[model samples]
Target: MRSTLPTFNEVWQRQCRSSILSDEKQFFSKNTFLVACSGGMDSMLLLCLLHCLFPQRVRAMYVNHQLQPDNEVWATFVQNFCEWHNIPYLIKKVQVAKGNLEAQARHARFNAFQQTICSEEILVLAHHQQDQAETFLLRLFSGAGVNGLKAMQKIAVKENIKIWRPLLDVPREKIEQWIKQDSIPYVTDQTNFDEHYDRAWARHTLWNVIKPRFPKMQTAITRTALLMQDADEILYEVLQQDFKCCGNENSLDIQALNDLTPARRRQLLSWWLKTEYRPSLDTVDRLQNEVMYARTDAQAQFFVKPFWYVRYQGKIYRLTEQQKKPKQYEIEIFDCQNIVLNQKYGLNKDLLKESLMLYPRIGGERVHLHGRVGTWPLKKAIQEAQIFPWQRDQIQILKKEDVILGIITPQGFWLAQSDYCVPNGWLPKLDGVSV
Candidate 1:
């Protein structure tokens, strides 16, 4: 009699043909599959399966944390396996930071993967349904919100590195059975059953007890995480619409942000910050209460690690750490010669021979702006131009001897003095403000 259970190859093929994994199949067909192998049963099976399916496209990467005493032995085993299978592989050694061993190891492992994998290659992980369930539970216990509770995704992109977990929904038992049936050589890590680590405690202790009472607990938890992911997608769609009305690429209108409900306001702030920086919940709360709702005249600013969100002139501008501006510089211009001033705002060839001094705003200065009748106070002019407060110091004042020649604002606008005005002369490119 034939066995009732399907073989590992049959299950893999079925999964690849499934509607959910059809896109992944197409992606893998076109991209190189770089598997993260740990020399354990799960990773070994993943590497073996991918190599069998796509021999020419499969490669393995092993990150050695040097935590366990047998790490070298495990690495050697993986190298031998890859060599036997004629698969190309790389072994990366990473220094795990001195802290929580599990978290540090994971961080080091992913950092190694990110540095090793190129843009065109796809990093494949062996996280299965049981791991997903544990992640969900861990995040829930740690007071994580919906975003965290959603846990691991089947496909994810981090720092421009694409990661695929094809076996995310597959049962761990299936992988074990396949490895046993195939007699695959794999090294077991004793730390997995130590119960000292959080994941080990969850798996060996908590899960062992829970499974006896609720056999389907893993399935239930995984299903809940999937539901949370669906909810997160809907929330993100709503956030996009809200952001469109209240925010632009780099700034958000204060009044419009205030118009949103408290929860939505926090969500928008969190979403905006997460686009480029990871902010904690406390930081978001402070931004809402201390910065966003501060007095109109108050110069409120909040620092969020390498970036600052400052409330200025009815808007919140996200800015990097301000760089020190030079006091002054000199440039020469000749007639019939066009000069490139940085990437944007080039001087006209019609300007006569002159030497101009570029100085930062020192106060009590005036500029006779082109097309304007009288001289305007430099402060008033910058305010009228709506230049950001943090950017005002970056504005350069152009002066030929005692007379103001022009002013270069951070917005890439060249407010040329009336004396230096030439029609259809200065080309505006607006790339970035550079001296």
Candidate 2:
């Protein structure tokens, strides 16, 4: 009555056939397939499958987000399972900064995998059909458009990590049956039944409603998810065209945006948010609606917590750092208070508060560089001197009496004459800070 473990060749052919390495018999990258094991039934089954297939190639990682007291217990369960099977595993601990436990835990796990996995590796997750179905229902309740409702793909990637879901086509019932047949024990998280969370409540409630009425709701939703992926492809193509004329993923052309049809525009914005920004459709409306209409001149920003705002001359522009450009006039450094600056900018101690008759470099302007033999056009000297951009704004023109000594362009902090530059190791402290 026991379920038979498939041969490595059999399992590889079944799942990995669609992989880019057309010939499985050929050389394949041997980096570990990091499995994010949660000690739950789905993840346990995934671990069992990988163990049955290629135990040596898989590395199970169970991250304790340190939220629930049982988190440590879960880590132990995964660790024991790995040790018993002679499989390599790593137990990681993380602290969830904010948001719901499930969401934060998942984020922490993926972040760990990405950080730990080398560039050549990929991560496997056990998000099965039930999760996919639940996600779809959740998206519906949340009023998510196409991409959200599309649900998680079988093979998807975020940042540098690849997420594989080989069991999406395998039902929960099948997983349970397979576990029972194979004698694979799995620990269930008690929080799944807690009605305090919407997801917990919806698992029992949403399926109960759809199963009786539609009977084939899961299948239909799965099919719709597939169709949505196809639609997403087309939508991305449209976005490519739109962005080409306007701009990239982050910067959208405000003028051209007004030209898009309301519905198409909404979809375009939705695509950008779901892809570029957060995974779910959490802030699609804010990005396309309130944040969009809030006006660049209205002084509203998308990332208010981070102190970033949007400014509009003709269209919306994101301004980070809550920074105000002070009236940028010539700072006659002769002022008392030190040159207090919010950010690092061009500063030349050589040019500070001096009565040097500094004139802007013109063609006829010439100055004798101290180390050099003869006088050259101050412009040519600056070019030869290698003055940097930031230093150009505050370059020193050390003229004794209406004559150019030399300029202090960033080009390696030039001193025109021997008297121009302060002597090396000169102890000139400024306002309590060392020069």
Candidate 3:
């Protein structure tokens, strides 16, 4: 005789006792759970389960993307359900950004969720086994590497917010069965049947046709994702070891990067940039061809959105846009200590009585070195001083009426003219350097 299957509550309790959930028992006990409910079958089941298990610790949040005409209807349904169960509830409305409708809607939804939940709350999602399978197929079709193929996890962190998906390993059929058996109320989203979205197309068009022939495909895909997760962890460990030998958070050593194998080099570059920014594979390839392989003396730069990655002096540095400084300003000598010049450079103390004018460098401008006989072109002087090309425009030229006092380099050092120098005198020091 076939044995009777476990009830939904029994299955949930059994899963909770599993090693993964058991390991996080203390964390789950300490933090309140904010369930992301969309008034859908899966989410409603998650909300119900959590509420039934830990009623006081569970709260429901519904994020309305406002993409559909019935968005408010869904929100009201989730709110009513929460009120009926006496659970704390929050509803956030978000405007989806312009772009791929599905991606933008997802981004907006998550943004709302992230903005609503605090550090003391763990954001719980309702992604199940089939959802993982669908994500795996989507990433696979998009040519994602091991990192992407790993898909979602039971526990993860995003932007310092902890996320938990307790039902991640549970199958969708089981969830539907439990919901129907318990007579839970939920609203159906008609958009799920629309094939215009990639996930919808994969589910309705691709998976439906394949499921009959390969009934166990979802389980197989989920297993593959688990393996990929392990592979991704190993790769991260290797990258950490490689990072120590090469560089730190802000920059990478060009020579060390070049010595790595082509594949490893690409991995390191992708890993390094991903710490603060997301870079496309094409961007990584372009950086390898244009910046890393450029001639040693050549100053090569690759733009990645708002910032630029530049190669100079055997190091690749990420350059953020600096704040715009005044084009020209006049200051008294007594205030020189508050400006951008190194005080060690000698300047006549008597001249402190006169005002000095500071101007940003323009092309063809020239300055005189203190010990040198003649004037030097400002551009040539900056180049000889080894200032970064990106920082050249930020150099300040100091003047006293018609006489050129000196110029302040980006590094806060002063190049005083011979006429302005005294055996021992006062100079100013700038506080910081632009990276």
The TM-score-based order of candidates, best leading, equals 3, 1, 2
TM-score per prediction, in order, is 0.81, 0.67, 0.85
Query: C-alpha displacement of 238 in model 3, angstroms?
Result: 1.0
lDDT of 1 at 232: 94
User: Which of the predicted structures, 1 or 2, would earn the higher lDDT when compared with the native?
Assistant: 1
Q: Write the per-residue lDDT of candidate 3 for residues 1-435, one digit (tens) a residue.
A: 322222456555665436334634756778888999999999998888777666678899999888888999999998877776688999999999898888888889888887888778999999999899999999988878888899998889988889988888888888887888777878999989888888889888998799999999999999999999999999889888888888887678988987888878888888877744446789799987788888877768787766678887888887665622222323434345454333555677766677777666778987677767787787787777787776676677667787777676766655567677765566655445321
In model 3, the worst 10-residue window by lDDT is 323-332
Comparison by TM-score, 2 against 3, better one: 3
Best candidate, TM-score: 3
* Candidate 2 residue-wise lDDT, 194-304, digit = tens: 878777787877788778989877777788888888897888788777767655644567678778876666666555544233334445566555556774456545653
- Residues 121-176 of candidate 1 have per-residue lDDT tens digits of 99999999999999998888887778888999988888788888988888898778
Candidate 2 TM-score, C-alpha based:
0.67
Runs with alpha carbons beyond 4 Å of true place in candidate 2: 1-31, 249-251, 269-313, 322-435
**lDDT, model 1:** 0.76
Alpha carbon lDDT at 170, candidate 2: 63
C-alpha lDDT of candidate 3 relative to the true structure = 0.78
Query: All models: lDDT?
Result: 0.76, 0.62, 0.78
Report the backbone clash tally of model 3.
1
